[model samples]
Target chain A: MSLTILGCHSATPRTSAHPTSQYLEINNKRFLIDCGEGTQVQLRKYKIKFSNINHIFISHLHGDHFFGLIGLISTFGLLNRKNDLHIYAPTGLKEIIQLQLKTSNSWPQFDIIYHELKNDQSELIFDDNKVEVYTVPLTHRVYTNGFLFKEKIGERKLNINAIKENPEIEICDYQNLKNGKDFVTKNGTIIENKELTFDPNKPLSYAFCSDTVYKPEIATIIKNVDLLYHESTFLKDRQEIAATTKHSTAEEAGKIAKKANSKQLILGHFSSRYTNLDLFKQEAETVFDNVVLAKEGKIITVDNKTFATELTINQ
Target chain B: MSLTILGCHSATPRTSAHPTSQYLEINNKRFLIDCGEGTQVQLRKYKIKFSNINHIFISHLHGDHFFGLIGLISTFGLLNRKNDLHIYAPTGLKEIIQLQLKTSNSWPQFDIIYHELKNDQSELIFDDNKVEVYTVPLTHRVYTNGFLFKEKIGERKLNINAIKENPEIEICDYQNLKNGKDFVTKNGTIIENKELTFDPNKPLSYAFCSDTVYKPEIATIIKNVDLLYHESTFLKDRQEIAATTKHSTAEEAGKIAKKANSKQLILGHFSSRYTNLDLFKQEAETVFDNVVLAKEGKIITVDNKTFATELTINQ
Candidate 1:
């Protein structure tokens, strides 16, 4: 799985800093998250293929989070996109997009299917053969949701040496071995399933949480997540402001990450107030030992056994 | 009158080229024209104060013309803008803006008065003591209108030497003299109005024409204008495509400028297919002697005496 942070700042987009937006590719399925203003230009800067994105997940209706959606949809029409596109967002977003299209008198050349989310509980929002996406309801001024993407477990791996020693195990019998079934000989001799097949790589999971207050309940739903992205809008010193705005401080995000027992945690959505961001790491490190900051054009890659990040300059 | 080209490209905004948007400071009135996506950042890039802009003019509902409007309004709310905002746009824009704001569950702190235009003929849309704005109806795929900004003719300039010679003329009568009234002395001596004062500089005028087909009617409306900005989406070689798309070629723009007898013509909205913009100037210079190319961050300053441009690098 690979994730690219297109923008990660809070509030308004600036000359250098942008708002919330990201590109996620998991299990070979690409998704766009929270298209803030200037997102299309960012996508172009990163050289991401626009046609690869089939689904978009919007966290909420905040201007900083979803203002660029209509422009992206409009560009799709200009580029003559013919594939079906799916959008997972709050219930009110449909009316907003439709009205804009109506006013412009231009609709997308392709079909747009909106999965307007309204539930207050964590619910499964998208499901495919290789991946499943669940909603993480968040606490904010208005209704909002984060998304959790999980790769489905695959069949067990075949033990090539073990199978080669057993001549009775024909090529046709390989399917049963991969299915973790025992091998039976003609004379009623049985071989254990574990001896014939090894376990496959564990499935990977990523949870995206943002624009929320210090809600510890999220830890339960996202427990043991491979990677966690939580909003750290402010540092510990500004906890009061974070609470007042229904945003989370770095310490609060750290507490959630620790409680969830995530393998890795990425801090993002920093407030525009303070130019000095080193304090965020110091504060979050007080509670959690592993923490990293999210910057625009940063790429995070994760697999069954390894997770790493690399920063690439776009400007 | 001064005009700043924030963006002036055709169709989708690319990594470098942006869409249609400009900042017009005419008669000391700051106005934003055609807010394409990423315009707020462009405004910041050019260091144009957001507070100075109270009025916005959208040419049409096309995304390239007005996609960045909602984001700008949202930023205004974030910045705690207390000044009232006036928007002049097509009839359907109000519904679009309102629906987006409604979905976000947030409204501006200041009042937003919308001037929804539905006129097909040239009509005055905005008039103040200092300036008057008229809409120039154009032919496009959708209903679009160009804007003509005219500075109101002010009081005639008082000839300081002539005024000082008449010691009997009181300060209170200075207003009358500036109003071009003939100076009358107590001894019944008469002085011609022209002798007492010089006529005020001809009211500086600018016509912004864009996203339209080659139409000569614009010449009649903006005759003898100081500056004219006409869409030159294509060169003369692509004249057929220009006609089919309802866009004007560089030569067509030059023809209109020549017919109007405009002091200077600025060509903009270049198609993305062309890499060498020098051809645009060459094509326009065929018919118009004085023509310049519009580039992002290019500032065109227009006064009664002269018209000048200075290119400022933003990237």
Candidate 2:
């Protein structure tokens, strides 16, 4: 799985910075989150295939979080998208999108499926063979929820050396061994699955916490994730304002990551008042060791282990 | 009057080019026309005073024409603007905007007045002391209208030398001369206003046409205007495609300007397929003597004459 940062700035769009928008690719499926203004252009700059975006998740209705959504949907109509598009968002998003389409007299030629979120507790939103998505209720000025994408554990790997030594073992027994079951011989002799097979493949997960105040309860829902993306709308100096606005500071985001025991932490949605982002990195690094600032066009891989690299803009 | 090109590209937004959006300042009031995506950022880049914009005119409901409108309005709320905003657009725009606000659970503190355009005939939309705005019925795939902004006639100049030579003229007759009327002195001397004083400053006018086919009837409404901004979405090579889409090519735009006897022509909304805009300028220049490409951030002054200059994009 790879996460692409299309935009990260908070509040408004600037020449050098953008508002919140991101693209995550898991199991070859592209998912867009929090499409702020200019997100469509950012998608083009990052060379993301628009048709590949099958699902979209909106955290809340703040302009910085979902302003570009209507435009992107309109662009899809212009591009003649045919596949069904699924959107998971707050209850009112469907009506908003439909109204724009009606006013423009430019309805999409494809199917648009909307899933409205209402639960205040963690609930499964989507599940496929490879990935499952759950919502984490968050504290904010408005009703908001975070998304947790977890990869399902795969079948165990066979120990070739052990199989070679036990040539008498039936092929069915080997299959059972690969399924993490103990191997049984014809004479009632049994061998532990750990002795015959390697460990099961470890699943990777990523949690996206967008536009929320610092809440310790989130750690329980997103604990021990491979990567965590948290909105850090302000620096440590503006903690008071951050709390008042139901936004998190960089230090607070770092603390969340540390408490969640996440493997890596990516901070984004920076306030426009910040001219220099180095201070955010400095402040976050103090609380968490594996912390990185989310830059536009930056891509991070979430697998058994997490790694990050910058993708060329306009690629 | 000054025109600031916030965005000038056809179709979708890219890293290098933007969709259609422009800011024109006529008299002292700021008017925004056709706010494409990312227009707010462009306004910031150009250092445009967003607060000064009290009026917005949308040509059509196409995404490239007004996708950024909701975002701009939302930003205005975020900035805590108390002044009321006026929008002149097609009938359904109000429903679209209101629906978004309802879904987002965010209502603006200021009033949003809407003037719905339901007639195909040309009608005055805004008439203030200094400027008058009228809609020019247009032919397109969608319900679209062009806008004509004309400065009201100012008080005539005194022509001090001529006035000094005719001191015997009645003081009341001088007021008539200022109104471009013939002056009759109390001593039975008649003087034409043209000879006694310069004619009242000829009001300057600008016509904006976008997403429209080459319709000659528009000349009747926007005849002999000082400047004409016509959409040239394609070059002559793709004239057939342009016609099919109800759009004009550079040559067609120039022809319209030449037929209307416009003093200057500005060609914009170029398709992304053409990277080198020199071809568009060359094509337009072949048909009209004074033709310039509408570049993003270029400011055009339309007074007695039209003058254009490039504004710095990033301050």
Per-candidate total of colliding backbone pairs: 0, 0
Worst 10 residues of 1 chain B by lDDT: B305-314
Query: What is the per-residue lDDT of model 1 for residues A129-175, given as tens digits with 9 covering 90 to 100?
Result: 88999999999998999899998887888999998888988999989
The TM-scores that each candidate's chain B achieves against the reference are: 0.96, 0.88
| Alpha-carbon deviation at A175 in model 2, angstroms | 6.3
Q: Which candidate tops DockQ?
A: 1
Best candidate, lDDT: 1
Full-model lDDT, candidate 2: 0.86
Going through the candidates in order, their DockQ values are 0.84, 0.67
- Candidate 2 chain A, poorest ten consecutive residues by summed lDDT: A306-315
Q: Model 1 segments beyond 4 Å from truth?
A: A185-188, A307-315, B307-315
Off by over 4 Å in 2: A27-29, A166-177, A181-192, A282-287, A302-315, B160-196, B236-240, B282-287, B302-315
